[model samples]
Target: MRLQGKLAIVTAAASGMGRAGVERFVREGAQVAAIDIDPAALKALAAEFEGVHTIAADLATEQGALDSIDQGVAALGGADILWAHAGMPGPASVEDLDMTAYRKAIDLNITSAALGAGRVAPHMRKRGGGSIIFTSSISGLVGSMMSPIYSAAKFGVVGLGKSLALALAADGIRVNVVCPGLADTPMKLGFTGRSGDPAEAAANEAKVVGAVPMGRLVKPGEVADAALWLASDEASFVTGVALPVDGGFTAR
Candidate 1:
């Protein structure tokens, strides 16, 4: 009940961290509007939940972002919490990276977040307060050999959150970024791309485990919990922080 009666909008909510956040937000008493590009999954989610609004839209585009926000506002009465969590893992290195792919990754990961926050700010400000949570990553704080473009995009998110927090403090809006480490989610699975080889996937996953001091990948729910805190009154005085929910992955 931490978010009782609040209106929340979460992007990329069809699966992975975004999906987890939608469920968590609802359980915490928030009226949630979930957005995703997958129509089938969006339909399934809408079928599974009551009072949850699902929108199928490509957030990488301005029109898509605007439409999603407009619908969420119409559904929820107003926007109180904004979780801009849509992202794609880009190429591993500069040498092998495609320029088009890199730009698209940035659009999805960074630009989409900017648009979401920009649209929600006026509504939030009108209500006299709100919380905006950006999904950054530990990669944002450090270099990642696995995905340079993704790291850059995430890093941009952290910067965006901080800037917004400072700019909106006078208006009573709080902005913060959550930087999660390796997490066991559909997106993580996709990164490995194990072709019908469970053992190889396990081994690949194990490598991630060894890198974290906690000895295991973080769970989507764990990240959701952190997000819940950030979006709730418990973090009333907290803003402009890029918090690491990385299980000590960046401790070194």
Candidate 2:
């Protein structure tokens, strides 16, 4: 119950790590406003979580980001925790990448984070304090051959978190990023494009596991747990850290 009585906002919360965070936060007694672009999934989530507030909005624009936060505030009185976790994978290589795809990646992964932080920091400052968590990735810290645009965008998120941490500390707001390794999610499945071949995809995915010293892919819930800790009073003294929930992948 580390987050008991807290008000949290989780972006891209229809599925994957974002969904997991929303679920965990609610279970820990937090009032959560879950934002997602997928209307159907958002509806399902709202139905599942009796007290949860779900906002179906596209966060790639400044207005969208502002509206989402405004809705969250309206629902929960104020936001105690902000999980800016919306993102999408771009092209696999520089050669194959298009400008449109690159821009989309930046919009979803970096710009959205910047806007979300900007919106939440003010409310948190007014309240005297708050926690902000960005969903970064191993790709942010290291090179990823799988998606160059995604890596670049994630790197921007890490940078945004660090800069915001320093700037907002005086306002009693803490900002940090969590870098998750390969995890099983719809996003990952979409990245691999191997929906029809489980065996082949599993073998290809094993390559990532082999690279990790822990010899496994991190679970979505596991990353959610780390996010919960960062958003709680347990991490009161922590800020500006790019924590790797990567199962030793980054260590190697």
Candidate 3:
């Protein structure tokens, strides 16, 4: 019951770490507003959690991000936590320089978090304090040969988290980033471009696992556990940290 009676807004909440976070927050007694681009998945999430509010919106735009937060806050009556977890894999590499994909990486991964934080902060201030969590990647800390665009966007997220943590401290708002390494989620397949070839997928996974000192993929729930701590009162004195749930992947 770490988050009992709390109100939260989670983006990309239909699957992976976002879904796990929503489930954990609710189980700990929080009423949540789950936001996702997938309407059907949002519906399923609403069904799974009787009291959860679900919003389907594309978060890559300023209006979309702001509107979702406004609507979520209205639905929940107030907000204590905003986990801006929506993100997408950018182009496979930077050699081609796909401007479309590059812009998308910046928008969906970083800009949306900024907009969401701006919109949610006022609501949080009204409630005395709040937590703002962003999802970055280990790529944020280090360069990624696979996708430099994704790396740039994720790095921006880490910077945003630190900057906002300092900017919002006076309002009792804690801003932090969660940098996940090679987790067992759909995004893992996304990183490898899950084609029909099973061998190719397995090979890619093995390569990624080989880089992790733990020699295994981090679980989605494990990332959620880290985020849950940030969202709760236990982290009251914590802020501006880019926590890595990377299973020692970053250690190397």
Report every candidate's CA lDDT: 0.89, 0.89, 0.93
For candidate 1, lDDT tens digit of each residue in 1-252?
899989999999988788889888999999999999999998888887787998889987889988898898888999999999899887767895688878878988999999999999999999999999999999899987777789989999999999999999999999999999888887886555526478877787788788899898888988888999999999999999999998899899
Candidate 2, 66-115: lDDT as tens digits: 89989998999998899999998876678856888788788989998888
For all predictions, the C-alpha RMSD in Å is 1.7, 1.6, 1.2
Q: Using alpha carbons, what is the TM-score of model 1?
A: 0.94
Residue-level lDDT tens digits of model 3 in 94-192: 676888878877899999999999999998999999999999999999998777788999999999999999999999999999999978888787786
Least well predicted 10-residue stretch by lDDT in candidate 2: 187-196
State in Å the error of residue 116, model 3: 0.2
What lDDT is obtained when candidate 1 is compared to the true structure?
0.89
Q: How far is candidate 3 from the true structure (C-alpha RMSD, Å)?
A: 1.2
Clashing residue pair totals per candidate (backbone < 3 A): 0, 0, 0
Count residue pairs with overlapping backbones in model 2.
0
Candidate 3 residue 120 Cα shift, in angstroms, is 0.4
Better candidate number, 1 or 2, judged by TM-score: 2
